[model samples]
Target chain A: MDVRQLSEAVTEKTKVDTTARDVEKIISGLASSSHFWEIVCATQKPFSVVAEIIGALKEKGLVRVDQEGEITLTPQGQEFLKENFIAPRRDYTCPACEGRGIGLEKIKEWMQKFDELTVDRPKAIIDYDQGYITTASVMARVALMTERGDLEGKKLLVLGDDDLLSLAAGLTGMPKEIVVLEIDERLVNYINEKASMLSVPVKALKYDFRDKLPEQYVGYFDTFNTDPPETIEALEVCMTRGLSSLSGEGCAGYFGLTRTEASLKKWSQFQKMLLSKFKVAITDIIDNFNHYVNWDYLLGSIRDDYSFVQVKPKLNWYRSSMYRIETVSGFEKIENRPMPCELYVDEEALIYKPDKSR
Target chain B: MDVRQLSEAVTEKTKVDTTARDVEKIISGLASSSHFWEIVCATQKPFSVVAEIIGALKEKGLVRVDQEGEITLTPQGQEFLKENFIAPRRDYTCPACEGRGIGLEKIKEWMQKFDELTVDRPKAIIDYDQGYITTASVMARVALMTERGDLEGKKLLVLGDDDLLSLAAGLTGMPKEIVVLEIDERLVNYINEKASMLSVPVKALKYDFRDKLPEQYVGYFDTFNTDPPETIEALEVCMTRGLSSLSGEGCAGYFGLTRTEASLKKWSQFQKMLLSKFKVAITDIIDNFNHYVNWDYLLGSIRDDYSFVQVKPKLNWYRSSMYRIETVSGFEKIENRPMPCELYVDEEALIYKPDKSR
Candidate 1:
């Protein structure tokens, strides 16, 4: 079975509505002889496409592939594809594009461009694992916004394409416009495509915030949310610039990093700087694994130059689990709720909607 | 009221036994009129000595000074001291000896000698502020130790001359012997003097721990307490080598730096390395300031670092104030126990007797 066959199978089974070209590019990428299993493991693609792709490869008689086994492209199969197949052209896959929407690729490209301008040049050191596990942490911010009635008809600008922010936008479902400023174009496109597919009104903007922001967007957003940049200086600048762009009595929700002494110090400094401009009403340090995941990989990806010494007395799991948040001016904390146990539940369980009437 | 009269007054008032030489050195240092106030501010000396020394200068008509003031030495007094007194005795008066104890000059020389030996060369980065706070933290540690029944007649070996460790030795009053290892011979001598003054049973040992420890003391200590060097590699080597020298089931209490992401990674690696030998237990990350200072400093000195960040949300004070402690391996956690509060009072309130009879 080939990409065409896999696409046909997915369309029949899931009604996902994807073109044969799109399926071909995705499958061919997966079927590349060099470490195909790793690609399958890393990509968060739906299960149907994954199964169909694998099934097609096995059925072709060109390769003996196991359905319940790890997928690897055989040498003969690799040669057959190279000789006979015309490689499907790769198009920017917009996550916000639902069912072949117009301008999906354009939006994806725009977000990609923005991400190139923003995240690619300088990597933000983030604990994606912690962010993955601490899913309930975002609820604190959302609750605050809801209590203040800021979510209704409010233009919320989410800076960074991390899953937390995307999930947050999907859950809250109140912001008049949820604009995502992302550094990875592919991620922006992916999120856009997902949002479009799900009928979530989230827009992806690809822009490097390090440089001066576009004048057209000045004062365009009312509320801002950011996962702080890695460097202390960059974080400070991001906070200042992000907050400065807010209109009216707007506030920014900072997913401030608070793990290491250095990060804590930076957060403290950022807080101090922000306190001068806005009034902080609520601050919490909580532990909720649903909000974050892949902590080991996140910490490893960020290059830390400072040398630290470790003293192993005993493992105190409770103390290490907590994280903190501070609510800025014009926002009031609604409640202190415990983290939900099932974080990776489907979108239906997690999507939050404020009052329908703006 | 010249230097002689002022010396006599101090001796009469405090009944602190001080030789004429000690009085003269202190008085002259104060009356030198060259950045005298800065020196007085920097040195951790008694206010009485500073007052008397200034009083003597005024009485002698050596200089006109302000009593209701931060002491300032006049130019006339400075010139007289430089030409007639300071130059001749500059070499004799040790710079390290601040007259209160062996001065900075002696300590510097001792540090130089310590450097010559290829041992304990990479000293731990001791944050003076954190160390100041640790004096109370150690008290809290003692409270925990008492609760654990780990503090009876056990031989407690203190590897560094930390003020907290010294105070812990004094307050517990149950250790078989408290041996303090200090690389600086002068500091060891000074600490010995302080211990004697306090009537604390502390034995000061001048030794570089990077090299092999003296065989006479090998495996002699039951409980090892030290703020170990901070680097993971150094800490691992130190803990392995130092803890190995302990008797069976003997525990070592190490107070060093807190964990960061890098430190956590390093610690995880260190734990893996030590898993074959030691069964680790007990870890606490205490963040409350009240857990480190009495009401005085908690309200005063610590007010400098506390402030709000308006961007991130704060935890609701009532709902979020409670913190949890869980059992990791061998020990059960005390319930409803808040983070250590009343650092000075509650920590010392518990009486500890180590199970030496076992």
Candidate 2:
């Protein structure tokens, strides 16, 4: 055979004219709403391309169009969706969002294993004033990290796991040790109770970031995670404590930081502290991975200052950036960086004012 | 009717018995590639729940089970999938990631209108050694913000748009004025040429961050966007220049910061510089918004030192954090900030050591 003919034959065989499958994919993905065909023609693909696709799908018996120009999927089209798209809901099903819009469903069926955790609301004693950790975010953290193999059989320390993420880690049936340091006795007891029930090899201690980290924990943990206060003083102290808890060389730490409280200035400071001082580099950060659902009370507290209080956040608008930090050159010794005695920063010191009224 | 009997009747009437729908939702969402019954048994509802659900689905003729205990969805089941899931792809589809796993599709169908801009590859003559901006990300940024009315009829300035994000903004046909100040002459010409071709009403000038701001450009734009080199000097210069380009009061800036290159310490310094001097507050940051497909050349440069280089990435793994910075108190004057004369930071200064062996 001639070279061109041989090439054409090879291409024909390999390609198998995927136009059929491509049409199916397009139809199945787009068969959601009535106006989808018009949408496809008007915005994404050109009218001619879309018309061609519609014609192909009609020939394939995957769709039907009415006189009103509305598009509806045929049984074959619906079958394609069933074959390819539908995913299950895990134990972390959202009663609030119902896995809508947030795309939590994509991760939840897999995140179910992290649901061995006990649920608790933030108490007044500890300052959840900064952030609230939802069960969904905990499951997501474990799932995403586990996918990266960052959380398997490692000794992890939770600097302030008010969220009870240790339970989630233990639920992974992975982490060798799950240690939590918390000032809130309620969280400690609740965590311990669930940990024991789940056989989660976890222990909780009533401690605070303000105090010196327990010596035995120094360089003992393979990883650490925290959602520290937003102020420089509190963040430095909390971060230093978290870093100090880490073992030397390639240890990791997960930090849940928010843009709402930490401005570019504060974010830069955090990067400097973790990257330069602790010798930890941020390799990955999933944007707004940690969504806070139970922050209504805190918002109520500042309601007078912020206008959004009247509307109240029905959706999970508050989210934190999750940083996966890895130790670069062992661990850096964080010395007397100011650890503010105050557990929470007052309104005056807040760099980020949430409401435009201010 | 007696009170108890009446209550029972009312309960029966209102109960409407949605257990069937619940069972279907569970089965449909969880059915993909999994012995879903096993998953249900292992992590979710009890055995009775599973048995009842399976019986309901089988009776409805939506699913079938074989003697081998394997389960498959029928045409009816596919219809359920069509009713519940499946998403359309957009021009913002990632060459590296294809908008999969990143959960971008949830927003991309609506994101296509933002793709009024065309696709452009990263140029090497300029400094993509810092960050690669995917057309997917540009569309995502524009789409997401445009949905929120951020880019509509606003004057925008690009500090170092090697990514040609300005083109995407111009394509929006929303921004009143799109101005670009870039150090790379090639980018300036390329962007200008495309701006004219696309009729995007964008103008580009060859400019460096270290140079003093020209008179008209100062506080002129409603917003600014930049993916600065990750050095305290380069970043500060690039940032200050961007801020200077914006007009006072309600003006904003979009920052493309990466968790990979800048360490915590470096990040802290940046935050302090922007937050303290500029009075900018970060309102939102979407992670993994910017996926880089053009880092192969940079990765190739240090191929010998990095072990992963041997595998050669077919999937785009590089991503950046998109920061939505709202200027508070309408742009504070930055003073005593160090602006490095050099636009690019050399490899030695990079905190992120991609090649571990080095």
User: Which candidate achieves the best lDDT against the true structure?
Assistant: 2
Q: Lowest lDDT 10-mer window, candidate 2 chain B?
A: B86-95
Candidate No. with top DockQ: 2
The residue-by-residue lDDT of candidate 1 on A1-358, one tens digit each, is 4555656676575443333433443445555432332332222123234444545655665445443334445766667556645231221211232111112232343344333332322222332222332223334344434433335455777776564355454544555677777666765786677668656678887865565555655566656666553444555556554555565222334444422212122333443444443433112232211123323333233212211101111211111122222232233222212222221112211111111121
Q: Each model's DockQ?
A: 0.00, 0.02
- The sequence of per-residue lDDT tens digits that candidate 1 reaches over residues B1-358 is 2444555676565333222333444445554323333322222123234344555665566556443333444666667555533321111111122111112232343233322321322222222112233222334344433322234445666666534355455544645567777666655776676667657677788865565555655666656665444345555555554554554332445444322111122333433343333443222222221121212211132111112101111211100011111111121111211122111111100111011121
Give me the runs in candidate 1 sitting further than 4 Å from their true place.
Answer: A1-148, A250-252, A261-267, A277-282, A285-291, A295-358, B1-358
**Cα shift from native, residue B1, model 1 (Å):** 80
lDDT of 2 by residue, A14-90 (tens): 22111222233245335544453223321222222333455545556766766545566787867855564321111
Among these predicted structures, which one has the highest TM-score? 2
**TM-score result, candidate 1:** 0.28
RMSD of candidate 1 to the truth, in angstroms, is 26.7
